[model samples]
Target chain A: MLERALSGSQRYWSWLIFLLVLMAIGFACYLYQFKVGLKVTGMSRDVSWGFYIAQFTYLVGVAASGVMVVLPYYFHNYKAFGRIAVLGEFLAIAAVTMCLLFIFVDLGYPKRIMNVVMHPTPNSILFWDMIVLNGYLILNILVGWNVLAAERKGVPYSKWVKTLAYISIPWAFSIHTVTAFLYAGLPGRHFWLTAIMAARFLASAFCSGPALLVLICLIVRKVSRFDPGKEQLRTLGVIITYAMIMNVFFFLLEVFTAFYSGIPGHKHSFIYLFSGLDGYGKLVPWMWTSVGFGILALILLIVPATRKKEDTLAVACAAVIISTWIDKGMGLVVGGFIPNPFEKVFEYWPTTPEILITIGVWATGFFILTILFKIAVSVKEEVAS
Target chain B: MGVSRRKFLKISGLSVLLGLGGKAAFELLAPGSIDAAMEPAPIGEGKRWAMVIDAKKCLEKQEKDGCKECIDICHRIHNVPNFGNPKEEIKWIWKETYEHTFPSRHNDYVSEDVHGKPFILLCNHCTNPPCVRVCPTKATWKRPDGVVMMDQHRCIGCRFCMAGCPYGSRSFNWGDSREAPKELNPDFPTNMEYPTRSKGVVEKCTFCAERLAKGQIPACVEACAKIKVNALHFGDLADEESEVRELLRHHYAIRRKPELGTEPNVFYLI
Candidate 1:
């Protein structure tokens, strides 16, 4: 099956090469960071976490969202998703890979990473996060590869594979929930101390993850002979619509609680993110841009006529991905650190090397995604023939 | 032919599980022996360390002359770097204003004397520290004496402890301390006895645990007493007659973010 990926059109090889160049640039920057310490990044004593952590948070959601397709197809016996279920699993493998890489690049002592395993402290949410994420990745690879291989051979996947798929459904939820606990369980980070954080994370993940899947399915349809099926894509659009609505609704619930309670601690982060607290509003415009895109995505996804059109659906999916990425990946982590524990605002922005290293990780993820998708699509095309 | 492969695997796996479980059961049954074997020896018998800062006396001294004797001595002895940039600054003990130190208690109409008074600040060494709770590697932990201790060598530098600490007490070595500008710190590691930390490790005041082990008080307390300010006091909280306990008994004192249930050992007398 991997041999299929080895032989591809010029476009495929070119794309891989392009990603390789970006990865090299990023690796170089990372080496520089490792030498000079985290000083090369934009983080400070006041804002200890920055871009790498934000990306890790958002990618965890994307990885968890694979359950959206897996659960409906596997548990509910929805036949429409059968065509694209493996695609969801493969996407999860790629996303989780990126999540782990982001964490690696962010560590100050990447060499000592095994200490998390060597001296595991059960009390730490990070300890659990390490367990769940690696577990989820392995589960996805096992289930996704075995199912696709069975499909290529025109046989039912074995019983063990089925059991693993069933286990993966709940494991998907655990990854994001553990990631949320990493933030929500911390004291004094009033912005992230919300009870609804896990719920909000799930809602955004459901929308954004499937939205990315929809766009990928469309691309797969354009470039390959095997279509993922019109009915499958349509059902995913409906899932995106409901999930985006829930994501927005959950955010407004946070807003209402903060303002209604009139607690400065509760309201300060929101104000800083939305309207600038004490004349520091670097993120205000970015927050509004996310809001605008969210509204745009909701309107496009809600209209059945537009959503039925592939072009309009593609636009809406792109909007949802961007909107959720900015909201979670940019705002959530940095906002919590503002007004540092001393009630003084110290803003964070990524430096050049930081941004490059981040890009390198993303490129590495896409490179893996391309090869995995190539193999899966080749199998599908073979089965169709 | 003697044993089927599946049967052999099952038997081997069962034996491994039993071996691990037996050791765990033994440890569970004899907890004290395992604890004694693993843990470092206790620092002092039945001692719970605490600190009391007399803010009123400190503010009077600061008002008369901008004195930072305590900060200078603690930083020097600890090999704390002077980065000269707040973003990269590292400190074991530092200063903050009264209003900023106690944000929840800030009143707009407070007296001019107390409103902006400089308050000496450091690790509260919380009785139930969130940093200890969130350290994935047990790199930062609380000793039995109520002092939150950091093991820099064991830290992976994930900075989760920084987020967990509500007081903002923990500081990561974002850059190498030894590479600090020569002008700011003319003689780096002024006290050769203390270790200069490498980059990418979190550090904070240990209540001068090394000095305490040598039967001396924390450097800040000694520095303040040397100047005749007598604003810093350190003693065993568990001892009713200790100086810290006596100060708390006679004066109204407050700890930062007491509502969070961290139960910080450091208290300030206003």
Candidate 2:
């Protein structure tokens, strides 16, 4: 059974070789980072958190997006998501692993992680965040493995697995919520201190996360013989469309509050992000690009002709994911810190070390995803045969 | 064995019940509640450290030679690095010009704007400090006395405190600050109280906690008193008979950004 599952087209071998080369290059950069301090990265006093935190923020959203599949299948009993349920779970596993790696690399001393545990602070959201992230990862593994094993043996899935599935619906929400709390609880940075931050984060996560999953599913169907069908794709596309609308609405709400209140603390970030401030226009171009791509993706997904076509839908998903990634990950963190606490403009651009380390982490996620998907797809095939 | 529907429901119920019970038991046994209530041992008898700055008197002095004697002494004693190069400067104590220091919009009633006058600013050591509330690692905390402080080793360098501070007094060490001068002060050498800071972590004025531990005034207050400027005053804010309290009552004193509800310990008299 294992041998039959392992057999695939020559493309898998070539893809593996490409990933290995990328991984080796990334490893070399990581070795340099270890030898030196964080000085290798482009982070300075004003912009302390850079690419690592941006990746962490984006991956947490992706990890939470697993709910797009889990909720409909487990709670609503929508059987259309059944084929891709395991895919969502595997994606989560990959995303969470990348999340932890981003955190580990960002820390000055990753060895002292036990200090957080040894002397716990219950009031701190970071402690709760760590707890929920790890717990959610474990839950996915347990549920995904049990279901796959049951399908392989032609037996009923464990009853406990259903309960785990229901728990993960809320657990997925918790991971992103805790990530938001890490920023929202902060006092000084007005850009992050908003009450709607968590909602906005979840909205964006749902939009991008499911869009990415849908695109992957389409590609899988084209390459292989497994088709999830047009109805399932349409349902997922509609979900993505609604989520993107909510994400945009949330962003506009933030802008309205900032300008309406006339608080320099709040309004300054919006101005700095969308427009230029004091000749510091690094974020302006990127932010507008995100906005343009986001609107374009939304239109494509909504239009009947584009949504119906598999190729067009795939492009729309890719566009939405890129747009959301830029808005939440790169532009957001950088824009928040530009006119720093001192009202001084400081900019951050990723250095070679930062870019290489980022690539390494992304490669690591892809590697995990490849192996997990192999197991899931193989088991599904056995069930069919 | 085929699992029955009844058995599945029963198992699910029991597992959830047990999980909640376990969580409750863990909370009761945890050290958090106990340690939080346990207060630190008192520092000095009838002496809670405080600062009283006469803003009107400060305006009378020149910008360069102004009441900055306190700032100079404080930074030097603490081995605070002065990169001199504006791009890489790390200051524990510094001055803020009037426009930067005060809310320019608020003083609508006063026509004559004071531009040249600088306020010698540092951490307010707020009674209800916002920075302490936001720290994820419990690195920055308040002492038994009125002073707020930081533990450098425990700091994760997130710099939330720098953002939390409304005064903009806190600074992050972008580069190693130890390259400034090797000749250490005999009075207060570099240690945990004044440990050498690395790049990325947030730091600010500690109100000379080490000096207060040894039953002496803060370096700034001592230096300002010596220079005969008499602009900067220090005493217990809590005590009615203390110099800080007397000045606050007799003279019109204000705090920076009183609207923010930080309850700043450092008072400014106009």
Candidate 3:
């Protein structure tokens, strides 16, 4: 099935080559970072985590979003999703791959990463995160491959594959929940200490993840013979709408709590992100941009006529993706570190090399995604014929 | 002719689980073996190390001549790099103003003497250390003596411990310490006996565990005492008659962020 990816149109080959070039550039920057240490990045003793961890956080949501389709198809018996369910699983594979890569690039000692498993501390959330993420990645690969393989042969997937798909539903929730615990469980980071963090993570993930899948499905329609189906795409758009509403509602709940309580610790990060805390608001513009996109996405997704139109739906999904990406990937992580432990503001911005390395990792993920999608689409085309 | 792919995957997965289970069983049966491998010889048995900083005395000395003997000596002995940029600077012990050191306690109407006064700051070596709790590798842990210790060799430099520390006590080696410019750190590793850390590791004050092992007090305490300020005191908190305990008994003292429930071992006499 993978060999189907080997033969593609000139456009497909060109896209892969383009991604490879970006990956090479990113790898070169990474090598430079590895040599000079994390100082080459925009992190400091104050903001120890920067872009890498932020991307890791965002990608975790994307990875978990695959359950949206998987659960509907397998448990709810939604027939429309059957054609694109494998696409969701494949997207998860790519997203999880990116998540792992982001974590690796962020490590101060990438070589000693195995130490997490070597001297595992059950007390640490990071240990559980490592277990859940790797487990989720494996589960998706197994289920995705087997299901697609069975489909190519025009047979029902085996019982084990069905069981794995069922298990993956809850496992998807676990990956994001554990990632939230990585932040929420830490003391003194008031920004992340909220009880609603896991809920917020799930809400945002459902919206952003499906929104991304919608865009990809549209792209797949253009570039491949597999029609992903209008009903399937419409169902996903509805999922994205409800999830984005929940995501916004959850954020407003946080705002109400922080302002109503009038606690400086609770309010400081939000103030810094939105209105500049004590004259340091590096993320202010980016945060507002996210807010703008969120409102636009809501407007586009809520109207039935616009939602039915493919062009409008694509615009809405793009807005949701950008909004969620900025909110989680840029604002959420960096905001927690501001007004540092001593109530001082030390800003963080990614350096050139850091940005390049990040781009490289994204390219790598897309490189894998292109091949996987190619194979899945080819199989679908074969089955249809 | 060969094992099927599914069967091979099952066999490998089961073996990995078995290997982990076997290790767990070994540790459960003889926990001392793993403990002995991880911990060095205890500096003192059944002891809880604590420090008392006489903030009033320290402030008086600072006003008199800007005394920074404690900071200088601790950094030198610990081989903390001087990057000259606050963003990348490393310090095991340093100073912060009263407001900055205790942000929760800062107020607009505080007395001139207490307000804006510099306070010596270092790791609190919390009884319930968040850093130790969040370390994925147990690279940082609370010793039996109540000192939070960091094993740089074991640290993966994920900086989770940095995020976990509420007081910003932990510092990561973003750049190689040895490569620090001569003007900034003229005598890098001023004490050759102490090992300077490599790039990409979290480090913090160890409560001078090495000095305590040699039957000497922390360098900061020694430096302060030598200067006749006698502002820094270190002793066993478990010992009722110890100087630290005696100071706490006589003087009103406060630990930073006591409400957070970290129960920091370091206390300041105002």
Candidate 4:
């Protein structure tokens, strides 16, 4: 089986070459990040966390969304997801890998991350977050690899792998919920103080995550013989639609709470991000673009007529992915920081180094995903043979 | 009712995987067993430290300066860097604005009536603190005698306490603070009473835990006492007969935001 999978790898030479070149460029950017401090990023004293943190927040959602498939298939016995359960697991591996990269880049000294473990703060949500993220990543990798190995060997099921899948279901939810707690538990940041933050994060994660997976599956099918079937796509599409609806609902709830409460503490962040705050209208256009794309994506996905067509669905998924990336990722962290504690407005724009490093980290994740997906596809072909 | 081997294989395989994942999650989610090693000893017979700020006696133009003497003395004695940059300031104690530092919701309409009068601010050393509540690490904790103290070594620099602080009292060490003071000033003695803060750790006023340990009042309190302005006072809030408690009853001393339910030990005579 291993030999057969290796033989299948030979066909994708051009794709492999392209990935290598991109990786080379990404590595070059990363080299610059190491030489200079995080000062090169768009981050400032007021806006301590910027693009890296935003990306981390988004990717954690993506990683956690894998459980949507895991839970339904294992607990409720949804068989339509059978062919692609491994895909979700593999995708989680990639997503989690990216999440860690974003966090590492966000850290002042990536080297000091180990201090978090050696001198652990058991009471800190961040400490718990680290434990959960690392645990989830390992659990997914082990289970995914073991299951794939079982199929390849034509061997009977492993007892441990089954037990591990059950753990990963709630573990997935924990990763993102804990991520939300990192914000919600903050004192002065009124926008993030609500208990609904965890729910909102999960909703957005579910929406964008499945949408991204569906798009990837379609692309894989187009470029290869790995068609997951129209029915499977349709089923996942329904999940995406509902999740996106909830995500949109969660965002609207935030706006309603902010405007209705009329509290300066809460309303200020929203005004700063969406409209102009203190004559600085930088995020206004980006925010509006996100809203426009969000509505467009929701319309395309929710309506069966539009969602039924593969091309249209792909476009909708891509649009939602970009919008969610902006709304939840970029806008969320930066917005939280605006109209600083003193009610002074501080603006943040990503510097060239910040953009380059971000591009590099993103490319690195893609590079890993490319290699990982290639291996998975190769293994699946061997099993089918 | 017949199930194909292929279908059975998928169903059972998924069930097994699900169970394993749940078990793994349960392990990670389970809270760590409480560390019994670091249990606090019973409070000994020592001066229970507290502070009194005579708001009226504080100089109008030199409001922060009066507070600064205490802050500078304590920080220098304790080897804290005067990191000049706002970004890198590691103030164990400092002055704050009427809005941020003192923050009277009533003061919104009343700040003009009390112009040029800014109260001396420090860690409330709250009997019950919100900072301690949200702390994921037990780094910032209230001592038995009501002094809020920090274990710098244990802090992960997550700054949750900083965020939880309504007073905006906490400051994060954004850069290396140890690089300051060009020449090692001889007046300050460095001991491991608190760990040297590394970059990314959050720090705030300790209420001088080491001074209290050595039967001395906090450096700020001593400085205020020496200046003879009768503005700063310190005593054990826990003791009913303590000066701080007696002053609270006799003089209409008020704590900032008693409504927040933190029960701050620090009090100001308005």
Candidate 5:
């Protein structure tokens, strides 16, 4: 099945080549960071986690989105989702791959990553995160490939593969929850200290992950012989709509708790992010833009007419992805660090080299995604023919 | 009868667990035997190490010409290099304004002088240190006696401790720790006795763990006292007869962000 990926058209090959070039540049910068240490990045004692960890956090959610398709197909036995279950599983593989690369790049000593394995501290949420993420990745790969193989041969997927599919449903939820715990459990980081952190994380992840998947499905419809089906796309839009609403609602709860409590500790971080505190307004515009996009996503998605229209649905999906990306990828991590424990704002923005390395990781994820999707679509096309 | 190897292994594991359980039960029942666990380790004991910074004396020194003498001595001893960029600079003991150091406590009506001047700052070595609790590798841990100690060699440089710390005290070695010596102070031996850290490891005050092992005080405390101002006082907070306790008894000392309940060992007397 994977061999089918090697036989793509000229446009596909060129896209792969372009992504490979970006990866080369990113890999080169990572080497420089490896030699020079993390100094090449725009991180500081104040802002210890800048771009890399945030990307890791967001991708964990993206990896978990595969569950949305898996649940409906396996549990509810929805036929439409069954057609696209392989697509969701493949997306999980690519996202988890990138999630891993982001974490590797963020480590001050990438070589010592195995130390976590050697000295397994169960007290550290990061340890559990590593376990769940690896487990999720392996589960998806096995289930997605075996199921596709079974489909190609015109037979039922084996019992073991079905077992894995069920395990992956819950495992997907665990990965993002553990990632949320990584920040939520930290003391004195008031912004991340909310009880709703895990809930917020899951909600955003569900919406953003499926939104990105829908965008890809639209593209696949144009480029390949197989269509994921209109019903599948429409169902995904509904999932994204409800999830985005919950995500926004959860964010508002955070806002209410901070402001109503009037505890300067809790309120100051919100102030620092939305407005600026003590004259640091760097994240203000970005945060507002995220809010605006979130509102737009809700408007375009909630209205049945706009959502039913294919073009409008794509636009809404794009809005959801962009909005959630900025909120989770930029606002959440940086906002947590702002007004440092001392309640002073030390701003952080990714340096060019940092951004390039980030691009490299994203390209690497997409390159993997492109190949995996190509294989899945090719398999589907073969089955239909 | 000969037992199977698997059963034997299970029995052995259960024996170990029971042994630990017995010790815990005994500690709960008796006071004398529990005393052994409280003994100071060579690195430093947890509550055994603390610093009391006299803000008045520090302010006077700052008024004179900026007392970076303690900073220089500590950084030089620890081989902490100056990377020039704030984003990458490393510090062990340094000066920060009272307002910045105690922002939670800072208020608008407070005397301009109190929050205006630079105050001595370093790791609090909290009784329940968050950094120690958060390290994925146990690279940092709270000593039984009370000091928060770090094993730089074991640090995987994930910066989890940095995010966990409320004080912003930990510093990451973003570049070679020995660069300053190689570039500017070629004659200096890069503090050969103290192991200089490699890039990508998080390093901090360690409450001068190396000096404590040798029965000496922190470098900044010694340097401040040598100048005869007595601004920095390092002593055991666990001992009732200790000078730090006496200082606490006599002065209205405050710990940074006391509301966070970290129970910081470092106290400041205004």
Candidate 6:
């Protein structure tokens, strides 16, 4: 099946080459960061976490979003998702790999990462997050591969594989929920102290994950003999639409609670993100841009006629992904840090090396995604022929 | 009903692995036992070690000419580098304006002396330290004696603790802490007994845990005592006769961000 990936057209090979080049450049930037400390990044004492952490946070959602498809298919016996379920699982595999990489790059002592495993602190949410993420990744791989393999052979999957698939449904939710807990439980960081944080994370993740899957399936349909089918796409579009609406609603709930309650500690973070608080509003523009994307996506997704069209739905999906990415990766982690516990805004802007290393990690994820998709699609094509 | 040797071995192996894992997790999760095992606190030492600051004296001295004797001594003894860049400033003890130090504690309609005066600030060493709580690697922990100790060697530099601290006391070594000038600054490592920190680790005032262990007062307290202002006080709150408790009893004192419920051990006599 992997050999089929090697025998692709000129365009596929070129795309793979392009990603490899980016990976090389990003790897070089990472080496530089390793030599010099985190000083290469935009992070300081005040804003301790920056791009690396935000990316990790966002990708966890993308990884956990695999559950949206798995849940409907396995539990509800939704036959439409059967054709493309493996791709969703593969997407999770790639996303979780990126999440792990992002955490690795962010660590001040990357070597001591083993200490997390060796001296596991279950009391720490971070320690639990590490366990769940790795577990989720392994679970997705096992279920996706076994099922895909069983399908290619034109046989029913083993009961063990079915059991693993069932376990993956809840495991997917755990990964993102634990990621949210990593932030929500913190004491001083008022921005992440809300109870709805996990809810918001799940809402956004469900939408964003399926939205990405829609785009990937569209690509798969266009490039390969494997058609993910129209029924599947329409159903996924609906999922994305509903999830995006819920995500936006969840966000506004946070806004309402913060301002209505009149807690200065809570209100200031939202103020800093939306309006300039104390003349420090670097993120104000980005936050508004995210809001614009979210609203635009809602308009496209909510309308009956527009949601029916694949091209328009693709555009809506792109909007959701962009908005959620900015909201989660850029705004959430950085906003939580700003108005540093002293109530003074310490702005963060990722440096050149930092940006390059981030790009490298994304490229690496895509590289894994490309290979996995190629294998899955190839296997499907093999069975079809 | 029919258990083959192969199945039996596989199940037993998995169970053994699971048992070991469960034990390991239980050990790590066991909060009290791990805390007790790690730092066998000095015998006969009363718990709840607290600090009290005489802010009125600090304000008067600072209002005349910035009296940073405590800050200077702590930096020297701890070897906290002067990075000069606010973006990368690594401070254990520093000065803050009265209002910034205490957000909801008061307003502009306060007394003229206390209103806009500078106040010395450091780690509150919270009794319920969120920094200790969120530490992914138990690299930082709250001792029974109330000092929140950070193991720099063990710290993965996640900066979770920095974010956890509400008082903005913690600092990360963005650049190498040992990069400070040995020749240019005569007092860089004023005390050879104190260990210099490396890059990429978070650090803050330990209430001079090493000095306390040596049966000497914290460098800042000793420095303040020498100046005769007696603004800084450190003692066990459990001891009824302790000076810190005595100061708190007489004066209208307050801790930073008290509403946050971190139960900051550091108190100020306003």
Candidates sorted on lDDT, descending: 3, 1, 5, 6, 2, 4
Which candidate has the top score in DockQ? 1
Q: Looking at candidate 5, what is the lDDT of residue B262?
A: 89
For candidate 6, write residues B133-162 as lDDT tens digits.
888888899877888998998888888788
lDDT of each residue in A134-199, candidate 3, tens digit only: 999999999999999999999999999999999999999999999999999888899999999999
**lDDT, candidate 5, A1-385, per-residue tens:** 7699999899899999999999999999999989988888888888999899999999999999999999999878898998999999999999999999999999888888999999999888888989999999999999999999999999999999999999999899999999999999887899999888999999999999999999999999999999999999999999999999999999999988888989888888789888999989899999899989999999999999999998999999999998999999889999899988666678999999899999999999999999999999999999999
Clashes in predicted model 1: 0
DockQ of 3: 0.72
Candidate 2 reaches a DockQ of 0.21
RMSD (Cα, Å) of model 5: 5.4
lDDT of 1 by residue, A1-385 (tens): 8899999889889999999999999999999999999999999999999999999999999999999999999999998898899999999999999999999988888899999999999999999999999999999999999999999999999999989999999999999999999999888999999999999999999999999999999888887888999989889999999999999999999999999999999999999999999999999999999999999999999998988888899999999999999999879999999888999999999999999999999999999999999999999999989
Error of 2 at A337 (Å): 2.5
**Candidate 6 structure quality by residue, lDDT tens digits, A14-59:** 9999999999999999888877788889998888899999999999
Candidate 1: give the clashing pairs: none
Better model by lDDT, 3 or 4? Answer: 3
Worst 10 residues of 1 chain B by lDDT: B36-45
TM-score winner, 1 or 6 = 1
Model 4 chain B: weakest 10-residue lDDT segment is B31-40
Write the residue-wise lDDT of candidate 2 on A181-262 in tens digits: 8878665577888899899999999989888889878877766666767878888888898899899999989989999999
Q: Write the candidate numbers in order of decreasing DockQ.
A: 1, 3, 5, 6, 2, 4
Q: Write the per-residue lDDT of candidate 5 for residues B139-253, one digit (tens) a residue.
A: 9988775668888888889999999998999999887866644555564545888777899999998877778777788888898889888889988877899999999999999
List the candidate 6 regions with Cα displacement exceeding 4 Å: B1-45, B180-190
lDDT of 4 by residue, B68-93 (tens): 57776877776676645554456666
Q: Write the per-residue lDDT of candidate 1 for residues B1-270, one digit (tens) a residue.
A: 599999999999999999999879978898668667766554656788999999889999999998999999999899998999989989889889988899888988988878888889999999899999999999999887777888999999999999999998989999899999999989997989999998888999999988876778899999999999999999999999898999999999999999889899999998
lDDT of 4 by residue, A47-154 (tens): 667888889999999999999888887778898776677788888898999888777766654555676677566666778888999999999998888877886678
Quality of model 6 by C-alpha lDDT? 0.88
